[model samples]
Target: MKASLLSAAILATAIVSVTACKKDKSTPNYAKADDFMASHAIKEQSFSGNAAAGFTITGKDGTKVTFSPNAFVDGNGNVVSGNVTVTLKEVLSKKDVLFSGVMTESNGQLLESGGEILVKAQKDGADLRINPALQNDGARVEIPKAMNKKDMGLFVQDKRQQGGATGGNQPQQSPYTWNPAPYYPFGNGPNSYSFSLPSFTWVNCDRFYSDPNPKTTITALPAFQDNNQVTDLQVMLVFKNITTVITLPYDFTVQKFQSYQNSLPIGLQADLIIIGKDSDGYIQFGTQPITISANMHIDAPIHKATQAEVDAFLATI
Candidate 1:
């Protein structure tokens, strides 16, 4: 009888110990709330100076203008520069796609805004949570309030064009007086005309062209010419349809040129290659070369003849 009583007492003690340990291991509701508050705490992030200038765009004949800004508030309540691109997938269906603007720091790091901001915690390491709401046009757009980053959308304004002024500028007339000069060096003849080539300020050789459509106002650099001193030259061409800029690099070969052409659409192909000399005295390629395709709708004076024509022209140079 005494052995039975002792065994019962031992079992009761074990049960109590297990219960206490379980209670100690569980997280309390209050502690969870405190953790959440600590992680989302943000300081002053404001835009006290002039807001960045808005962009202007003209729509198609029957289309309307639409614009929006991607915004985000930092820990100090400061607004960072970023893009908010709104793609009009379908107007009739009211379907649209919105992408947050990505911002790069001076250190070359990239950050994305909008939705949930990634947050850091003392115990949890890194986490994501919804950001706070932003005021826009007398309404609020709810955003995740985490420490990561946030992006907001801005309102757009539009105006209609009228009268002869239209919304665009008028064409300007050339100031040079007409003079007949020899075109070919066949001595002086009445039919000979000395045409003045357009002049352009040489920006950075690596600068990309910025145009969605072809224009007589802008012309890409010329192609590379091979000489006996240089064995080979390679050029790289990058083209974007949305921006409509064709960037050409100085160093590219026939194979690289073919690769670039293959990557583009059937109608959007590069027209020229730009080349220069490297530090080793060998002819190097340009950093950015404009892509000119023959399929463009704009009737720009710039022309990219066939490969045979290009070779013939290079031979002359």
Candidate 2:
């Protein structure tokens, strides 16, 4: 009887010890980690989050077609939630449209979900179409033709004429003679004018040319530094009378936001540059990166350019 009682006591203690150990063990929260991984993986695939989100579709001719989020449909005929932007080379007079958007499951299975679609002929041009099975084929809708050279040239000339005047009217004979001292961002005095220095230059070939073998060039400028970090830089370029190349000078490094979202082992990088001359003269302009965080939106350096100054600079090119 004593042996039996001792054995029971020993078994009860063992059960309690096992329960305590289990309580001490940390339960793995796979959900949170999975969520982070998923978000990061999709970051690179996300659109630039610009007002426009779509691909440009170019045809054999120079035409292109642009499609918005409203142009797709899922297998069940449900409209997709996300926006899709497409640019086509030229408008099609008549053609069949077949496209699809699908979501892949964790198990490597594809499921057709919500999407938008159109199927009709209007006086404007071709009809819009969507299909579930089409996703397997990897085909996209067609695009419209790009603007002709004459039209593009006219547009550029109009921009130059709108500016106050050209170098012909200026007293200075050199284009670089525009008082570089006053243009520096940290000039002293109440009436001092300052502007950010150009960061890069992009050159692109004119699309109007018959030859499609246009080459582009991009030149990168020194990065502006502040508090040990790159502060501001401007990229400028001209596009005119060239063939097919488009150049952009930019640090295409994977953005921090993208890195966090995509969970990429390493980020991506690219740059663009273009240069051209219009009927008025050479045209130069490029985009600059602007960071707006929760604490600050407009950095002091970016705000250095007054509206009048920007307009004047735009006019000169």
Candidate 3:
């Protein structure tokens, strides 16, 4: 029942209060950000179809994907046929991006993401793949225009390092990175950005963050109740002047969340948000307005948050 972000200008104060407001009866005490997202973010949609006849599926947000006949192939290079299940998860907003923990970047370059979608198919219980014959513009994906898609190109998940706690319980994480997606012509229609995807994986519509402004590194410090007890906190930089969101990774060596070197543009305005679970298993968040300066640092004092409060705050981003 706590509605702090809506009428309260979604955290109107700089360095907003970072103390617990009491856990909402509906919010669970989760120890990991992955667990929180799995329970609360958008759920995947599945459709039953036959690979021999082809099928088309749409997401809850109007994301459309079409699989051609015999498009699915199983391991050992066998073509799958009947009873194939196609799954899709659409991440279209800043809220979805954060809760889903999907990062938008390519080989260390920042991206202003328009949206992202996970397309997958399976036969019975085994994983399937797109036939090599159709790997080049074989399957088509059309994401509805929800946010700005200017200069957006196709990008796909190329690699990701393992995440979770290290041997010493030091929470370790490396956000997955995307690469210049395959040459599957990108088009911007009136209502959607249409492109062809060769295989089943994560596809993102993103544009390289191009700015000539002088860049610098930015660091964030999370206010921990126990001083330095590491939790599942997630920190992100949300740009006010442009549609860009980048997650800051925790530097266990320095005990701070930091971004890429020479990444932030000097003089640009932005809001830094730190939200995740506490060591005690309660959801907490902090927000502060900031102007990028040379070697800038931010100290975010996080407070308790309910599921509803989390949703409202994400909507504003």
Candidate 4:
């Protein structure tokens, strides 16, 4: 058995080496990236200290895989530490799939969103099979019934667009745009505010892993608010028609996590309710729907009015 395993490793190394040496740019081979991940399957990784401070592992093909601290958050919002085995079903080039988002649950179970292909991973006794929800949306969808679980992770990108209005495979626009118009109104004036159709933001834990280095921070998008006053910010995401709500930290503020929102995949949407008591002690309510695809500025003003007016404005949202 030992000899056979050694021989298998040698043969696998040779196959990946050949796959990497291919010189054709027009039809570059991805079998090597796929193969390397298969041979080096990580059953469980152990981390100490801040597990939320994620780490990156570099594959033999130089692919850097990073995981956000939230990726390991349990259902109760606690960061997972200790020995956790995450299997890669398959590793393909960025050009292979349309949309792919991988998230691990509290028990370290893997969930794949978008993309027709399904990779199977096992946790405890249940079979983590391919989901049909991601297959319903786009044109020219191809759902592979099964995939190799140990190499399931595609190292190229987290989000991708195959064919769309822009024509061929192209990256989508920035998730958040910098605009200072929080007071901008929607339709008419003080009471009637216009709103985009509601979409939920995914913000249970704002931490993200864009790179392998723990010290590397996200600095692209700007801050939303300066002071941290409002807490209990929450966002939701829908997959396969199932709604999943994610909550942000109690001290979360617009300014602290606007940039984090900017890093989310384009096309994800969110909704927010603005309610409070006025100086006169009367309760006021306001709401706005936020889209994270191309625009980031919240121009709609929250109307502080009667319950009826608030309900009307919320109807538009």
Candidate 5:
């Protein structure tokens, strides 16, 4: 009888010890990590995560991203702190993309739960909003608030076109299409006096010279695309169901709200149409316009393009 009792006691103690260890140990929340990887366009096929080891993933562009063992939290939101590393072997092997950051346990919980809330509410995917400054140091974007990824995708494509990527790819198909000049954002007519608002000078091409000028044609020129240079003859802002026509010399400015009788929200998007004769004498050009939000306070940088520059661009197009 004593031997049986001793065995029972040992078994009970062993059970208690095992339970304690289980309580003390925690594993990574694989689901949350997987969601993060997918949202960033990173491939999660090779993902490996656990309490005893680290987390890792490969991006679509063949970049490798890894988190230290404790970089993630468990099911209950407790952070597991470990070393974090990022490798861009195929993306930027020669360039350095190293980053470091610190996240308190509370912060991790907030971020994790925030993402969950967004995915549920949006039905569509969400974009983790990290502070722009954090993006500078190679730190992965700090997932704060989530943005509607579809809307943001449109926004980024517009930005690329405005930055002279017009010839790189066809304009993305969207219900609302507005094209800003590949050279400049704002238009300033000859001798404008509104110094507070800025205007960008752009080259307007004339593929079909009319009147006294002779039309010049390049026999060896490549096929025409939307990238041809054009001047800003007129621009109009369409938003809040109101169309505000801006003639020669207009400021894509914060004051645009006044046109709506102050009915426009601060961050609301406005579609723009720029009608001007291209170098070929064809009236063709339109683009989406960005908002004059807080980020664009005072004035945004001006982009200028010349007629010669426009011709040079056409040659390549």
Candidate 6:
């Protein structure tokens, strides 16, 4: 716990302010950490095609998506035929996952994710759905394969578990889990991982995190000297040796960040990261290295940082 907490403390210190900061519409001085994250998020790739003929588009990141002919249907179940638009948001790396933030856990079990993608379609100013009967398998998606693991299976993200903030865009900070999917990916060699569309919202390649060490909970406290300056706060755990990342949910009752009970492997080495948007719209960050231990309460630091510095740290991940 101390190991992860220390890292969080370090990240809390990298606070940066800029006119470019994003503020929530509801509040004048308040900005959400999620909004900050989304501001620097990876750009979405868009494509256009007629629903009757279908189309395919490849993202700069090498994510390939195909829309089969008559693949989409209206809310009334009528086959859509006019020009349709599609957007793809691909998260292929650990840093990408942090920004897109499709969390890695299901039923309290940690997951190791390879990649994730959110695909959506629009027709004539309205949303559309995949026609499962005609295009369940016809809607093919291929994500660039970075690391291939035979255990890496398909999973779907559930927004219902997001603890309410499911309306706008994907919540940057949610404790949702990824449900294991029966669908499998082909082309597991080197180029990419290919699979048919299972369900749209969010999909990824993931497997349960395995370890022989005992598991325990870790606690992190990002005690900013001027608590009033902080608005949106986020605590994160980055596994050093494994391809896994976790967003520690804040415990309002205790006024600190905490991990899932018995979710972390004892002796596991991880870096704790804390990020918050100050009331003035400045972004703060800190990081520290820690090794898991029993009954730990890690403390963090408070310092200023620049947007360049923050981007540098994210690039290292």
- Measured against the true structure, the TM-scores of the candidates, in listed sequence, are 0.20, 0.22, 0.80, 0.23, 0.18, 0.80
Residue range 224-265, candidate 4, lDDT tens digits? 222223222222122221122222212133332222222344
lDDT over C-alpha atoms for residue 119 of model 6: 88
Model 5 stretches with alpha carbons more than 4 Å out? 1-48, 74-317
Q: Candidate 3, after superposition: displacement of residue 186 in Å?
A: 1.8
TM-score between candidate 4 and the true structure:
0.23
Off by over 4 Å in 3: 1-39, 160-175, 225-230
lDDT (Cα, tens digit) per residue for candidate 1, span 137-179: 1111122222112222211111212311122332221121111
Q: Positional deviation of 127 in candidate 3, in angstroms? A: 0.4
Encode model 5's per-residue lDDT on 166-213: one tens digit a residue.
222221212221222233222122321001101111111101101222
- Cα error, residue 152 of model 5, in Å, equals 24
**Residue-by-residue lDDT tens digits, candidate 2, 1-317:** 99999999999999999999998885532222223223323111111111123333433442222334333444455433343432321111111101011111111111111111221211113222333333322222221222222211100001122212221221111111111122222212232111221111111111122322322212244322222222222222222222111111242452111111111111111222211222222222233432212221111122222234434433432
Among all candidates shown, the one with the greatest lDDT: 3
lDDT of 3 by residue, 26-51 (tens): 44543344555677677889888878
Residue 235 lDDT in model 6? 82
Model 4 ranges with Cα > 4 A deviation: 1-242, 246-263, 311-317
Q: Between prediction 3 and prediction 5, which has the larger TM-score? A: 3
- The lowest-lDDT stretch of 10 consecutive residues in candidate 1 is 91-100
For all the candidates, what are their Cα RMSDs to the real structure?
Answer: 28.4, 24.8, 11.1, 28.5, 28.7, 13.5
List per-prediction Cα lDDT, in the order shown.
0.24, 0.24, 0.74, 0.28, 0.26, 0.73
**Error in Å for residue 107 of model 1:** 25
Query: Which candidate, 2 or 5, would have the higher TM-score against the true structure?
Result: 2
Stretches > 4 Å off in candidate 1: 1-72, 76-132, 135-243, 246-262, 267-270, 280-317
Please give the TM-score that candidate 2 achieves against the real structure.
0.22
Model 2 lDDT at residue 230: 26
Clashes of 5: 16
Ranking by TM-score: 3, 6, 4, 2, 1, 5
Backbone steric clashes in candidate 6, count: 17
